[model samples]
Target: MEIVQVLHMNGGSGDTSYATNSILQKQVITKAKPVVIGSISDLYTTNPSPCLRVADLGCSSGPNTLLVITEIIEAIDEICHQLNHNTPEFQVFLNDLPSNDFNAIFKTLPAFYEQLRKEKGEKFGPCSIMGIPGSFYERLFPTATIDFLHSSYSLQWLSQVPPMVEINKGNIYLARMSPPSVLQAYTDQFRKDFSLFLRLRSNEITPTGRMVLTLLGKKSEGPFGKECYFWELLSKSLNDLVSEGLIEEAKVDSFNLPFYMPSRKEVEAIVCGEGSFYLDGLEIFDINWDGSDDDDNKKFKFDRFISGQKVAKLIRAVTEPLIAYHFGDAVIDVLFNRYMEYVSDHLSKEEGKFVNFVISLKRK
Candidate 1:
């Protein structure tokens, strides 16, 4: 699959759109808020700029996109307010692949600006928001231009599907039963992709600039731990459809998502190997698959339909395009419907969780 062309969150604000189904991502942003604030605080303290250049890399279109930018701006404003300095002008760039829905983000800008004006009054410094369509794995900005860079729940996506995926003919991603070779292929791809990401950003960011990244990750040493089961379950749902002749088995074989959940060790190793950035901070948070909304309910009657539907919507928002391209749009709904059922059944038995990694880095 051509990831650049086909891989994108469901566009526009509809029921199945990523805009509506991104609570999990929002939770990730919330979890990383402290790190984001700290990074922004340090950015201004060490290298104060009257006009700060910020880029939200892999910033898919949605409310969360603006939420990130707003948080950064607010943090800067708070810092300047405490330090008795004037607020800085912001040149904010929203970045994602060319296929992302830039129009959706544009439509919401009016409301965003209105909100900012109301909150900050006349003290709100000049802020410019524009969309830049490109992959962060490559050079997206000119040398030493960006002041601070942020990406959330995005770097987990590999630039492209691994070339040696033929080793795991029956599966879509790394599964518990997947051989060591399959895991190695994913590890190698992530190392290559992340090393390139650091090198590119190292060139674009000022020597004192900072970057904060929040990505889906694994807590255990192996890949077959938390946050990795969702794909495994998704593959099972597709296998069921293949048995029922709803989709061809060969189609499933030919499909693999351009995604990987790296362990914290792997992230640190790559950062060191690249030798372009200093790892300032690294943290791993355990997030429930449903963003921890259902954690308090244990004795309550489990509503299979609602729980299944919720998880299904979240998964579909992110993976619909990829699945539809391979299985045809006709089976899209049917496939997700079955996936919901499977997810509901699994959640009923045990709590589902994702290991999320939030890292803070500085250009060398």
Candidate 2:
């Protein structure tokens, strides 16, 4: 099998720095505990490799990344307790682009180490850890080295620019409808990127190693245009800014979408075609960015930030810089304000959104 490294350059999720960190702190320690438990149980029962040598492939240099990794470790430890198995040694490979903020990871590790001491007491063990900088869709681990692989709120980014988006050429979307060409362009690139991921990992992963991917995706089909609500709402805001002269038209033109979200079919097709992995499980649920409108609910339910079904807000932070770069500072403020308002309006019209999916696969 071929080996390659895929650059995780999307800055994690689309959330701003503060929001991203907060969400990570909340979700990883609490919400994902169960998921990680289930994932490990599935691995032990179904996978040939079971020692918990896990690699977080798209780990950005951020608190949230650490939070997730730490939680996964805790979950595994708890599971082993119930099962009465000797806690297996764990090696956590924190990966990202070469330019990631390694300082953040190093700075926080000591504190995390202290926290682990508090939790585990005399049983404390060094988290066999290292920072590996590179891409995942390309070469990553040594041949047959990794036992379990995981990535969250990543993998939605295309490894390269979505094909056929040349600047000199005409608009990729032939009309306001966003057209079929654009969809196919994004689809083909997603397939190519994902296929490379499977091929690259196939050799290193044990015959039945486990992998989990949690990422954002759209339900719509057509390209980014009037029909897709996300595209329409954002584009209108940008167009409104253009009309007000808040930003230059060239800035908008230069700004291309750095990532693409694939539908379930597109994702399934790509994985199935690879022939090295099989879908062990998949879940797609609704997520809404809008806070619940019920006044009584808002006082407490929304304040704590946990929702029965809420989209991952951290993903929004990762895109804020890109949003500011494209739309200008003034435009971004107006845009996000309008976005929240739009979410409210959308909730009024169609109800809330969701995080949508959690997919697990096992190598075959």
Candidate 3:
């Protein structure tokens, strides 16, 4: 499958659209806020450029897209106020694949600009926002043009599915049941893609520039871990359809996700081997599948069915395009319904959590 052409969140503002179902992503960004603020503040205070150029790579459309930019601008504004420095103009670039909902983001610009004017006053950042469409694995900007960079919940997506991953039959991603060859194929692909990513960004960002990246990661050092459980449930759901004769078994066998959740060790090795950036800070944290469920009160009544539906919607919004492209649209509703059931059963047995890695880097 052509990932660049087909890979995009469900667009528009409808119920199943990414714009509406992205609270999980929004929670991730909020959790990583301090890292983002520190990175932006440090970069600007150290360099003090008159016009700061920033890019949000893999910035899929919706409120979350601008949410990152607003946070960065506000951080910079606060630092400038404290330092008695004039607020610098901003050149913000929101980048994602060509198929992403750039129009959805574009339509919100007027209100965003108005909000900035009202909050920061007239003299505040004439921040110019533009949409750049392409793959981050390839160079998207000129040399030394960007001063700061940010990407959240995006890098786990490989540039393309590994060529040999068809061997990973029955399961979509790296699962405990996958063969050793499938595991190696996935690991090799992630190393290649991530190394190229760092190299490309090293070229685009200034020497003094810094980057803050957050993505799904795994707690274990091995290829298969708890992180694979999410995809496994989806696979089971598809297999249930297969049992019902809705989808062909061979189709499930051939299908594999273009995603890999790296371990912290894997990430550090790639950054060190790439030889371009200094890893200033790296952290691994856990978030529940239901973004809104933060409390640990045992006395509180937790509705597993409701939480399962919520999680299913979030995954469906992100993966429906790819699934539809692969298996046709007829299977979407049934597939997710079964998926919700599986997830709900799993939650009833035990809570599920996603591991996330947030890293701060500077060009060496």
Candidate 4:
């Protein structure tokens, strides 16, 4: 499948849309706020520009779309206030695949601008936001033009599915049952894609510019871990449909996600090998599959059914476009219903969590 054409989160503001189902992503951005603030503050203090050019890569539409931007702007404003400097005019670029819901983001801009004006008063931003449609795997901006770059919950998506993963039959992603060759294919693909990403961004960012990236990652040195259990459950849900004759086994075999969760060791190796950026900081954290769950509350009870529904909706919003494109729309409801049940049962047995890596980079 052509990932550039096919890959995008579910668009619009409907119930099933990513706009409505992205609380998990919001939580992720919130968790990474300190790192983001620190990076932006450092970038602005060291090299204050009259016009600040910022690009948010893989910026899928939703409340989270502007969350990072808002933080960056606020950080800069705070610095300007403390230093008694003029607030730089902001030029913000929101980037995603051509298929993303740019219109949804566009519709919300007026309110975003108005809120900025009200909060910061008249002499503030004069910020301008625009949508850039294409893949970040390729260059998106002129050389040494961007002052700051940020991405969240997006880099794990590979440019395309690795070749010869047909051997990864009965699974949509890396799993315990996957063969050795399948694992190697995924590892090699991530290394290649991530290395290229660093090279491209290094060209676009100034020498002193900073980047903060957050994406799914694994704690183990090896690829196979509890992280694969999430995809394994989804694969089982599809197999359940195959058993009932609702989906073709061949179709399931042919389908594999264009995604890979890299380990911190792998990420560091690639960043070093790419030879374009200095790895300033790297952090790993975990979030429950159900975004709303309060992990800190000792008295909190685990509700399998509710957690199952929440996870199913979250996955569905992100994957439905691709799944519907490949399997036809008729199977969406049935597939997710089975997925919900499987996730619910799995949660009852064991709580599942997503491992995330947030890294800070600077151009060499």
Candidate 5:
């Protein structure tokens, strides 16, 4: 539950004016439709009166959470309309770690509420929104009360210290590549975190509730998940620095990521381990793959490979904490700037990397 909350050049947060809401809106709305429907299908029936409670676990501050809540509600509204029933009065609970900035989220609520009220959506009902901040690895809401749960780019976070990481030794949390010791520790942490998640939710989710999750996962045999390439590179780079006495080994050893990425098998096992949920449907797809042309066939002419500074900002926002934790805080910016250069160089030689994953689990 304890995580090092450090910030550097990073993307936006709801709390910060980074416009994460826009990024989240773009990222989640498109990919979440299927899972949203799947979750709704589990609990919705052809009844005139609709009663549903949905939770967005690890819902970060600002626009992303609010946008996702809307997308999910709209999906449910479609289902309700298809069955030809009055829309339900929905209660949406957005939860995250206490460290997350809820004040910003609350500040945006009136606008979000007003926006929803003004828009004539397919799902037209008074939505009750509340902020519940806490750890998802532990207890969440009341027993047998939740109808749907959704977590995105979250769950991959490990629950505790990775077992194989020895603080005493110089290795710290850097996953070993050949033997996969660090990876094993990370996997174990995920297993523990996920088990706790399911157990906690088992008490809260109704008999036929559904949960949809998306996390960065790996298809590579590499030590880090494909989604975590930057982190892996950063870790190894620091270790290299330690080997050369350019940086302190002690500093490198002191660092670890509270978050991680999981494999499809790893995720499936977590849901199955609970025994209360079934994998009704699943999907794995690439996101942000820099195609020769964008989805709308809009060609971005970046003389550099990464296209724009926005991509740079995103990686910086997400990786600065990890970078600063290992290397001196002094070099965090330099490290990512170097990484961006490499990204440009590499993309010129080859296409940029792709992120893949599975989204699953439908309760019976």
Candidate 6:
């Protein structure tokens, strides 16, 4: 698949839109707040300036994109206050693929700036927010232009579907049923994409600049862990549609997700091997599938708030566009409805967990 053209979160603020259903991604940004603050803090420690250059890679359009920008600026403001330094004018770049809903982001900027001026005073003179549309796997800015770089919940997406995936049939992602070769293909793709990412960022960032990245990752060596079941059930749901003759089996055979959740070891090896940056800090944590809405007090219980429908909607919001692009719109609702039932049934058996990796890095 050509991921740059096909991959984007469901757009606009509707029930099934990514803007409305990205609570989980928002929580991820929150979880990475400390790393982000530290990166900014370390950035200004050596290169204190009246102007700052920052970029948020894979910044899909929505409130979350702006929220991340606002938080970074706030962190910088607080750090400058603590260091007795002057607050810097900001030049922020919001980047994603060309097809991303940048218009949505632009529409919110006037109000965002107005709110910023009201809070930070008119003396917060010159802050420029520019939208840059491109894949982060390559260079997007001039050399040594960026002071800080941040990407959250986006790196896990491979630049494209693995080349060998045609040999692995009937699975949408790397799952328990996928053969060893399929897993190896995914691992290889991630290694290549991530290495390129580091190389590009190393070029764009100043010597003292730092970056914080939060993405889905695995603790175990095996691909099939807690979150694999989500895909397993989703695959089952799609198979059910095929069984009903709602869609062709060939369509399913050709479909595969351009995503990979790397293990901590795998991540460490790639970053170390890339030789562009050194890992400043690394952390791995677990979050519930439904944005950590699990009520441990009622583990055996099930409710609408933590229902399969919610999880299915979240997945649909992020994935429907891609699936529809390949499978046609007629089956979109039916596919997700079946997925909801499967998710509900599976969640009833066990609470779903997603492992996330948050790493802080500095350019060499």
lDDT of 2 by residue, 116-150 (tens): 77887756445667888887867877887777787
Candidate 3 global TM-score? 0.98
Residue pairs that clash (backbone atoms under 3 angstroms), model 6: none
Q: Please provide TM-scores, in order, for all candidate models, with all chains considered together.
A: 0.96, 0.78, 0.98, 0.98, 0.82, 0.96
lDDT of 5 at 50: 64
RMSD of each: 1.6, 5.5, 1.1, 1.1, 4.0, 1.8
The count of residue-pair clashes in candidate 4 stands at 0
Model 5 residue 362 CA deviation (Å) reads 2.5
Count the clashes in each prediction: 0, 29, 0, 0, 6, 0
Task: Give per-residue CA lDDT, model 3, range 54-141, as digits (tens).
Answer: 9999999888999989998899999989999889999999999999989888999999999899999998968999999999999999
lDDT of 3: 0.92
C-alpha positional error of residue 221 in candidate 6 after TM-score superposition, expressed in Å: 1.4
User: Which portions of model 5 miss their true places by more than 4 Å?
Assistant: 4-25, 46-49, 82-84, 121-124, 165-179, 220-227, 236-247, 289-298, 302-305, 321-329
Question: Which of the numbered candidates is closest to the native, going by highest lDDT?
Answer: 3
Off by over 4 Å in 3: 296-300
Residues 40-86, candidate 5, lDDT per residue (tens digit)? 66557622236678898877655566766777777767776787777
- Flag clash pairs in model 4: none
Better of 1 and 6 by lDDT: 1
Ranking of models by lDDT: 3, 4, 1, 6, 5, 2
Which scores higher on lDDT, 3 or 5? 3
Q: Please, what is the whole-model Cα lDDT of each candidate in the order they appear? A: 0.88, 0.60, 0.92, 0.91, 0.63, 0.86
Where does the lowest 10-residue lDDT sum fall in candidate 5? Answer: 7-16
- Assess the local accuracy of residue 90 in candidate 2 as a C-alpha lDDT between 0 and 100: 67
